[model samples]
Target chain A: MNPLIEFQGFNKFFGQHQVLADIDLKVQAGEVVVILGPSGCGKSTLLRCLNGLEEAQGGSLRLDGQELLGPDTDWRQVRQRVGMVFQSYHLFGHMSVIDNLLLGPLKVQKRERREAQAQAEALLARVGLLDKRDAFPRQLSGGQQQRIAIVRSLCMNPQVMLFDEVTAALDPEMVKEVLQVIQGLAREGMTLLIVTHEMAFARAVADRIVFMEAGRILEQNHPERFFTQPQSARAQQFLEKFSFVESLPKTLHKELS
Target chain B: MSFDTAFMLSTLPAFFKAVGVTLQVGVIAIVTSLLVALLNATILVLRTPYLWRLVKGYVELARNTPLLIQLFFVYFALPSLGLKVSGFAAAIITLTFMGGAYLTEVLRAGVEAVPRAQLESGRSIGLSEGQLLRHVILPQAGILSLPALFANFVFLLKETTVVSAVAVPEILYTTKNYIALYYKTYEMLAVLTLLCVLIFLPLSLLLRYLERRLQHGQFGH
Candidate 1:
């Protein structure tokens, strides 16, 4: 079967500086592909390129076999099929949580208010934020806000969701709730492309890991093999660095108890 | 030369009429200029190609040139070219033009200050450019711009003093005419200052109330 998402020899640049080079990756339907890389390693840029948030310099990107490059491509339609959740959870501060969710459904999709609000309320319940329906962004905690942001994207009923470090900004205690929501999506077989620093969450949720370095895919492997035995020296160094931070809380907990 | 409450009282009727004209002209200009500025700032934010050039050029011209010169062009120059506008119309149009540009620059900054993240989230939801502006950008920009816009509103009202040159007979016009006839310069100037204080103090209070309410998320009206 053809991949649900494809990046064939994709090239992206900022001015003369190349950010992503010759990216050749593919994801089957309902696959959760976690992109792992250090800051400025083009992991998030790769996800951004899929939704046309970043322009590509060369090559083709496809959503369900349709070419997304060049002038003929329509981004509005592409973006609707590929929802994105940012780290900052950019819910409209002026609006209530329900308004933020209903905006795309009623305004962009032109769905009936009753139907859209019903779907939004259902999704809010799924994310465990149904009680926050009337609260504004500032009123909610970071975990609640992130879940609402996820629900905001999910309201579009996109074929795939791109999560760019959605829980990175939350307090440590709050990160688990956001991760649990994402894990629930993975269990329900949602096609997801995530750029995240949460190594354990990535390993737990991703069916496949696409490890990147500089601007190229240095390694692509299954989670067990990738975590137990990262092939490249750079990826090994990256994992070793992350393992300390990831294991710190557990170690600290053991020491305290 | 003695302080004369009696003369101040005698000047009240003309002052009231002048205050009426000033407010009529001032409110119209402020409202229309706000609309114009919002439109121009949105255009610039959307980067609408050649239209942005027109808006940018207008902003530069309006911000740099004095309001009095702009009124002269509207009231004097336009009539010479056979487009005779009444002094009241000239005052409204010129003030709108000037405030539009000034506040466009002011509001453009506010629009730009809206977190790039907010715009990206809007796009992620597949909002059309018009929808994004209407639902996302403008609401946030409007709130962020309230203080600056109010400051500009007060400035535009004070600048309405120049309308006397075009025979609109607003506050300054009445004051000058009263001083000319009665030569009650001190009494007239004091009443003029008093009238301005009366008009503006309530407005400043309203602005403060509004800013606090919006900041606290009691958003409406």
Candidate 2:
């Protein structure tokens, strides 16, 4: 089967500084891909490129076999199918949570207000935030706001969801609830591209773990193998910092070298 | 030789009537200025290549030059170019344009004050550019700029005094007439000053109240 999303020879530059260099990858439907890297390794930029937020300077990207690179792409339509949640909740502060969720469906999708509101309430309920329907973003805690931000994107009924460290700004206690919501989505088999430092969540949830550095994907593998036996020296070193060495299965370590 | 108290008292009624004219001009200019300013501000914020430059030029021209000159340009210079308007019309038009320029700057600051993240969220949700501006950008800008916009309204009120140069027969125009007839420059000038304070003090206070209210609305505190 064709990959649900594909990147071929993808490259992005910020003036003289190349952010994504010759990136190539494919994501199958219902697969959860976690991109792991330190800061400024272009993990966020790579996720942003998928949604056409950061236009690629070269190469091609395809969603369901349709071209997604360059200015000619219908970004609005692309965005409708590809939702992004930011590290900073970015909920519309001037609006109530319900209004925040309803806006895209109502205005862009032209969904009826009654229908959109109904869907919004249902989605909010699933996240256990139905009571916050009338509350403004500032009235909610950072965790509640991030959950709302996630559901706000879900309201668009996106085929693929890209989360850029959605819990990075949350308090440690708050991070669990937000991750719980994401894990729930994963269990329901939603296609997800996640950039996160939550090693445990990535281990439990990601089908494929992609290790990246210096604007390139150094290696990618199934979660068990990648965690237990990192193929690249860079990946091995990164896993060591996470202190996975103590947990590394002996047989897997022999295969890794 | 002393102050003609009786003459001043008699002209009070005419001065009051002229105050109505002044208010009418001010009201019309305020409404029109707000519309023009909001549109001009959107243009300035959008920064469309050549058009933004044109708007920038207009803002600079209107702000740098005196209101008196702009009125003169509208009333006299435009007529010299064969586009004639009544003195009242000239005052309103010139005030609207001048107020709009000032408001563009005030509002552009407000627009800039809106968080970039909010705009990005709107875009991510697939809101069209127009929807983003309407739903995300403009509401926040309106709240942020409300106090400054009110101050501009007061500024426009005082600037209406310059309208009398074209014989618009507004408050200052009629007061000048009383001065001419009775030659009581000092007394009439005193009355003008008192009337201005009476009208403006309350408005300035209201502006402060509104600013507070909007801030409270934002914080819900």
Candidate 3:
């Protein structure tokens, strides 16, 4: 299958500081790719570049067949097809959960209110948030708010969903619920690119795991090989320092014995 | 001193007539100021190079100088330049220009208070810039701005007293006329203060109540 999104030699700078440097990556339709990295490794900036939220200074970036670097490129149109979930769960505080979900369909797609309401209801039900329809963002827990953010993006009927650490702000207990929602979305064949530190969720849900450090993809491979046998010394050292490699061997040994 | 019933009775009609002009000038000035402030604020938001500088300059000039100077400029200077407006018209124009400079800063704070995510969400929903401003930004900004705007109105009402200098027959002008004829300084000033208190107190109360109701409805109790 052809790549659904491609970033080639992408370079981004904020004044004198460079955020992303000579990065290259591709994601296929219906594929779930997870980028794992330490903080300030340009992971969020990479996602921002994909949706045209932050412009890349030099690169060839494309979504489907549309070029993102051209002078006449319509970022607004591209944003419609590319939905994003922020780490902070940026729901409209003034609007209800149902209203937040309905806004995109009604405003963007020009769907009738009744029709949009129906879709919103269905999506809310899918996200397991039907009962909280009229609740405001502040009224919900962090996990519920994140789920609402997910459904809000889904309401736009986007082709590719970019998640920038959706569960980073949630409590540990709350993290699983959000991860479960994302796992379900992955199983239903929605294309997803997640930047996260949740290795277990990535191991379970991600088709491909891409390791990033200092604005470049250090390694990319299938989840099984990437976690079990990372090719790059950086990846190996990273897994080792986290005690991830040591713990996994002990767990496997216990299972076998 | 014995109460002069006929003198007080005759003053009532004149007072009412002056009140009418006061209301007209106050309402017109407030509305004109709101429009001007909204336009000025829009220019500030756009951040266009020359236009932004021009708007800032206008705001600074209006704010730094006294209202009396602005009113005199419109009244005396404009007539010399071949635009002879009536005193009432000139007062309204001057008050609006002066009041607008202050209101722009008040309204601009409201506009800035709206979250960046809200604007992003509106754009992500495919709203055009105009639609975003009209539907999303302005409604929230208006609600957030009502308190400041009402405060400005109260100040503007007090400021309208200065129009007496331009010969507009508003409440203060009428009071001056009454004081000149009767020499009842205490009673006339007392009545003037009472009238202002009567008009503005309930308005202020009503705005407070509406503000509470809007907050409860939009943001929940």
RMSD of each: 3.8, 6.3, 5.4
Q: Using DockQ as the measure, which candidate wins?
A: 1
Q: After superposition, how far is residue B192 of candidate 3 from its true place, in Å?
A: 1.2
Q: For this target, which candidate reaches the highest TM-score against the unseen true structure?
A: 1
Off by over 4 Å in 3: A224-257, B1-10
In model 3, the clashing pairs are none
Write out the backbone clash pairs for model 2.
Answer: none
What docking class should model 1 receive? medium
**TM-score for chain A as predicted in candidate 3:** 0.93
lDDT of 3 by residue, A1-257 (tens): 66999998999999988988888888999999999887888999999888777888998998997788988987767877888998888787767788778877776678899877888889889878899999888889999999999888888889999999999889999999899999999999999999998887889999999898888889899999988999999989887777755466543434544
TM-score versus the correct structure, for each prediction = 0.90, 0.88, 0.89
Clashing pairs in 1: none
What lDDT would each prediction earn against the true structure? 0.91, 0.89, 0.86
lDDT by residue (tens digit), candidate 2, B1-221: 58777766877888888888888898899889888887887778877778888989999998999999999999989988999999999999999989988988999999999999888888888888899988999888888888888898998888888999999988899888888887889889878888889888998898889889887776454
- Sort all candidates by DockQ, best to worst: 1, 2, 3
The alpha-carbon deviation from the true structure for residue A155 of candidate 1, after best TM-score superposition, in angstroms, is: 1.7
The segments of candidate 2 whose C-alpha lies over 4 angstroms from its true place after superposition are A70-72, A239-257, B1-9, B74-85, B183-187, B207-221
Tell me the tens digit of each residue's lDDT in model 1 across B1-221: 49889989988998889999999998999999989997998789879999999999999998899888999999989988999999999999999999999889889988887898888889989999889888998889878888888888988888899989999989999999988998889988999999999998888888888787986673422
Which scores better on TM-score, 1 or 3?
Answer: 1
**Ranking under TM-score, best-scoring first?**
1, 3, 2
